[model samples]
Structures are given as C-alpha cells and as structure tokens.
Target: MAATLTRPKLDVKSLDPYTFLAVIGKRVIHPGGRRSTEELFSLAALQAGQKALDVGCGVATTAIQMARRFRVAVTAVDISPLMLERARSNVRRAGLERDIEVEQGDILGLRFPDGRFDRVIAEAVTMFVDRQRAARELVRVCRPGGMVLATEFFWRQPPTDEAREIFLGQVCPGMQLDQLDGWVRIYQDAGLSAIEVRSGPFEMMTPRGFLQDEGLVNAFACMVRGLSHAAYVRKMAWLMPRISRAVPYLGYILVRGVKPAAR
Candidate 1:
C-alpha cells in the first residue's frame, strides 16, 4: 500500500461541514452531480495514462473514478484530515491504492513541483480561498498545454438583497459566489487560455439531485442519517426551501482553462 502523501493538522472548522455531509452518507458534496463530472471529463477528454491532480478532493470518489474510467493516476489532496482519512479508506476499499494517492494539502499552495500533472481539477473549492491564487497554483502545477477543469456554484442571476441575506448570510457566512463572467475572468486573469464556463442546475442538495449523486440506496440512507441529528435536520429543512427560492439566481458552473504550451 502507498503511504499517505502527507498528514496535515486537523482543522475543526473544516471538519464540521464535510463531516456533517459524510455522516449523512453524502459522498459527492459538490453541485452538478455525476452527470456534470462526466461532462467535465468529456470536455477535458480524460484519457488513459494521464497524471491528474484533484485538489480539495473530498472523499476521492472522483479520483478513484478517474483511475478506473480513464486509467489515470490521481493525486487527491484536501486540507481536511477527516476528509483525507475517509478518502484514503475509500481508496483502499476500492483496491485502487496504486492508482490514487490521498494527501492533505491546500489548493492555494500545492506541494507538487512545477508542471507536474497532466490534468488538474478542483470542484467546489475555489470559493473557499483566494480564487486567483488558487487558479495560479492550478496552472503552475499543470503541464503546459494541459487542461485544468473545475466546478463551482455560480450566481446565475443577480441575487436580490433578500436572497443574499437568507442564503448567503444565514445559511453560509463568508461564502464566496461569483457570476459566470467573474469566474471566466478569474482564469483569463491567471494567464490560462481557452477558458470556458458552462452552467448546470443547482440540485446538489435536493432529493432528486441527491438520488442521482448518491444513488437510490445511499440517498435513502443519507436522509435517514440527516434526520437522525436534529441540528442537521433543521438546517436542511431551513435551507432547502430558501435554496429552492434562490435557484433562479444560482447555478453550478463547469469551468475549463488550458495552460499554454511553453514559449
């Protein structure tokens, strides 16, 4: 078995959100579900023998899938120890120890050498950090001409002050959401080329989305676990309707940027 890449200290604040989702059997925490992920792979043309990096790769499900689907080797990194622990466990359970390596690292300051990976991916992570710096780091480690793909929650329609208050302030504080153009500007500003952004429905937390993301059995299990904790249950109840209402203004985005070949 490959040793874990690195062990970073646990951050309690980071642990809570992912742990909450994990406890409820929520493996795919990002929006857009499997469909969008597959779309990303198709757009990126994920192929055999590529070396990929999955930054902030919670639970490493996509990492493992990349290993299986395209025969790529993946380095899956997340700052959260709890997420890495489970990711490692899941990686081992799938007998993909050789294909995917789980590590604890920050996306803004990746530990890899320059131009190390053929493909770089981060889903639902740039919002939590300095997006421009993260984009630079992503481009830095990717080989020239390699593709960097990501998925994030974007503001589809401008948020009304009320929508911002209920969803942004109450449900999640310090949440950084950008419009589609803002996201495109991020990659373009980072000197990446061939920038592209595509939007998808924001059904990541809804029952229909959950069912597709977690599968029928796990989705049912997630609901059971989510309900087991009153705090979590109430948070879900409070957020779902408000999120639904905000759907007109919110959507998930799939972004692609390419590192230009060396001059």
Candidate 2:
C-alpha cells in the first residue's frame, strides 16, 4: 500500500460539484464520465512500459485503469490533499501502488522536466485555470512525438441566459468553457501536431451517465453513501437542479495531439 497522507475534513457545502461528487464516492467525476475516458484511452493507443502522467487525477481511477489495462507506469497527481489521500487509498486498494504514483501537483505549473513522459492526460481540468498555460504544460512534459490528451467541457450549442447563469454563475464559478473550435485552438497553439478530436454530450449527472460511469453496484453504493447523511443530502439537492439546467447546453471535447518530434 502507498504511504498514507493526513486526511483533512472537507466541508461538503463549500465543495465544488466535482469534489463533492468525489467525496460521495462517485469515482468518475469528469464531464463525459467513463465514456469520454474510454475515448481518451482509445486515442492514447497506450503501450506496455510507456510512462503516463494523469494530471488532476482525482481518486486515481483513470491512472489505475491505464496501468492495469496497458501495463504502463503512471504518475498520478492532484492538488487537493483530500483527493491525494483518496487517490492513494484507491491505488493501494487496486494493488497498484507499484504501478501508479500518487502525489500533489498543479496544472498551470507542473514540476516535471521537459519531455519526461510518453503520454500525458488531463480530464476536465484545464477549464478551471489558465487554459493556455495548462495546455502548454501538458504538451511540455510529453516527449517529442509523444501524445497529450485532455477532456474538457464545451458549449454544445448557444446556452440560454438562465442556463448559462445557473452553471457558470452558481454551479461552477471560475470555470472557463468554450466551443469545440476554441478548445482545438488552445492545444494547436500549444505546439501539438496531428491533433484529433472526439466529442459527446455532457452526461455526468444524468441517470444513464451515472449508471454507465459507476456501474450498477458502485452506483448503488454512491447513492447510499450520498443519502447516509443530512449534509450530503442537502448538497445533492442544491447541486442536481443547477446541473440539470445546464446539461442541455453542455458537451465534452476529448482533444488529442502529439508533441512534434525533434526537427
């Protein structure tokens, strides 16, 4: 098992929807959920013995999958102490401590050296920060000719004023979302080549998406855990309605690009 870190108590009410979902044992917390993740993996074309970095790793779910499925070495990083603790626990529980490394990291400024990894991925993370810098950092850490991939929320269509307000104003303040073309440009400007894109509706909160992402048993577990406490119940009540209001206008973009090989 990985070494345990100090677990900090999170105030449920104050947590953003993603963290709140993670707290309630929802393993897949990104925009397109498990379906998008599968698209990412397909685009990655991972190979045995490659080095992969998963930024904003949440609870190491994707990292565990990458290592277990592709036999790759994964360094999983998240900024939150609570998230790191949960990631470590999940990695250990999967008996993948040896395969996956869990640690603290930031997206805008990563600590890794240039071209250190063969594959780099960030799921629904760049929207929360300076996306250009974040995209550059993801590209920077990938070896020349290596792949960098990210999943992000985008406007599927023009959102209504009320829908936009409910999401960007209340549910996810400070989150920056754009249309599919805008997202493509961010990575293109970051110096990636041979870019590819796949997209789907944002369904992380929908009943079908929840079941698909978590599966039947885990979905049931998450619901039970969510309802087990008053605070959890209140948070869900506050969150679901707002999320529903915006879901109609939201979608996810999975963008893949390759760092240009040395000239």
lDDT of 2 by residue, 46-163 (tens): 9999999999999989999999999999999999998999999999999998999999999988899999999999999999999999999999999999999999999999999999
Candidate 1's TM-score: 0.90
lDDT of 1 by residue, 69-151 (tens): 89999999999877898899999999999999899999989889999999999988888888999988998999999989989
Off by over 4 Å in 1: 1-19
User: What TM-score goes with each of the models?
Assistant: 0.90, 0.96
* Residue 136 lDDT, candidate 2, scale 0-100: 96
- Candidates' lDDT values, in order? 0.82, 0.93
Compared with the true structure, model 2 gives a TM-score of: 0.96
What lDDT does model 2 reach? 0.93
